[model samples]
Target: MAEKIFMKGCEAVAETAVRAGCRFFAGYPITPQNDVPEYFARRMPEVNGVFIQGESEVASSNMAYGAAAAGVRSMTSSSSCGISLKSEAISWMAGANLPVVIANFQRGGPGIGTIQPAQQDYLQATHASGNGGFRMLVLSPMNLQEAVDMTWQAFELADKYSKPVMLLMDGFTGTMMEPVELPEPLSEEEVAAIRASKTWAARGKHGGPQHKVMCGPGLDTRISQEQMNERDAELYESWKTTEVEYEDYMTGDAEIVLTAYGITGRIAKSAVKLLRAEGIRAGLIRPKKVYPFPDAAYEKLPLEKLRGIVSAEMSIPAQFAEDVERVVHGRTRIVTALSSGGEVLDRAAILDAARSLMK
Candidate 1:
């Protein structure tokens, strides 16, 4: 039997990254996610992998980019502010088709708003993460166990698509501790095999031939840039068909359903149960994959049965609510139950909203 270990969500992510064959990690300390780098700084060395605490988030992102270009399973992580600093590198990585794992343990933020958990970065995570209109596979894990699982899968998805993959969560998810049965760690041989398979990895040519890995605007030529953009667009569209994940909880028989992600999704799930106990037919459409937005899941909902769709998140003006609105497409009235500035949405608040909407 797999032994369940009690671990903080942040530490679980770091440990799982290593187990997934990640050998290079660079990050700076940021509140709500500091334990990620802290764990990597200690564990990476033990595994004979490299860990660097860059002077700034920008530097950390570039360092991760370089490591990934060399075909190492590499990653960087930060809060929303730090992610903004890393944006340029992220855009560059996407252009280069570099596979890298990134995590955003978001905090309240327009500009350093608060350090407590909040889902204020929904727009940043899903719609416009970086320049050049690049899209990433964004996974928002609701619990420590899911965090571990998602972090483990992130490396594979990043490599498979040759693009950055984000593990998006909040401070509450990052700092919370829970019992989890982590997956088995990859062996040294297994890690080496994975690394060796990347034919483009930066190994010296022994003075024979040199290869170039370019991620710029492509030789300053219109044709080159156009070709690059088209290829990127194709990949982005492919994700819509290939990568979408969500959970449907009693939605089959529901009249009121809630939509949420990350920590807020967990809260909404609890709210669904509370409503159920009170004889309300509430359900939840909790998205595990935020980007590729899980639109198909929304389309699959029993629209004829739904009375209302409530978006439960912790953001002002409700960033994710915009996507939910688009998905619902005027089929039913949409509403929001939001808790901002580090506040968790009260379960009762969500329950009451669903009840009132049904009435």
Candidate 2:
């Protein structure tokens, strides 16, 4: 078995990014996610990588953008409001088709609501991450191990698609500690080869044509922009078929199903076991990747046999429920167990919602 090391969630993500060959990290300090930059500060130097604590979230995000443009595996992290500050740069990275990994250690929202964990940014992450209609592969890990694994994979996926990828976790998950077997660090030669592969990056001329890194279709005319949008749309659609990931736990004979992601989904797994002990036939469908949401999980469900599908999340007004409703299409009743402003979703609330559906 691989040896495991106990590590905090944020620090694990930072270390994993370094192992994945990320040579540039630029981020501003924010609650919950500050540990990410802190770890990178100490570790990046040892790895001969660059770590910049930019003056602000906006500056840090754009700095990562610049690094990624030069073919470096780059990353940035922030909390909810800080993420908002980085949105414009994120969109630019998307528009430019740069591969950059982003980590959002989500916290209570609307406007610096609190420094506590919350899934209030689901809509922002999946729907309107930026001004553009571009989409990102959003990975939501249920635990620190998954967080480390996903952070490593985020860089690969970002490079694979030439687009930004997001690791979306709440402050609860970011602050938690767990034992994880991290992936091996990339060798210096391997990192060099990866950078060499990015011929499109603006890395100066190497006895060839100079590369130009343009952002957002390069001020193209309306017709040209439309063409670019269509091409980007196809790329986004491809992710649904190739990147959708979720866990279907005890869902085979379930009458009550709980749907969630990230930390809330982790808790919901326990709720499923409790509900099963009580003979409720409860199960869980936890999306590992929320953007190209595991819609097929819902599509494959025996909707008629299910009494209710509970959308459990740490958000007010139940943002995740919107995706559930969209996928289920009213074929079965949908409910929610929600808490916001730093409050977490408890098993009792999920149980109450599922039991009410039984009534």
Best by lDDT: 2
Ten residues in a row with the worst lDDT in model 1?
214-223
List residue ranges in candidate 2 displaced over 4 A.
220-223
User: TM-score for model 2?
Assistant: 0.98
Note the residue pairs that clash in candidate 1. none
> Model 2 lDDT vs. the true structure?
0.91
User: Tens-digit lDDT track for model 2 on 283-303?
Assistant: 899999998988899999999
Relative to the true structure, candidate 1 reaches a TM of: 0.96
Clashing pairs in 2: none
**lDDT tens string, model 1, 137-228?**
99999999999999998999998988899999899989999998889999999998888888766676656465655475576343487888
* Winning candidate number (TM-score): 2
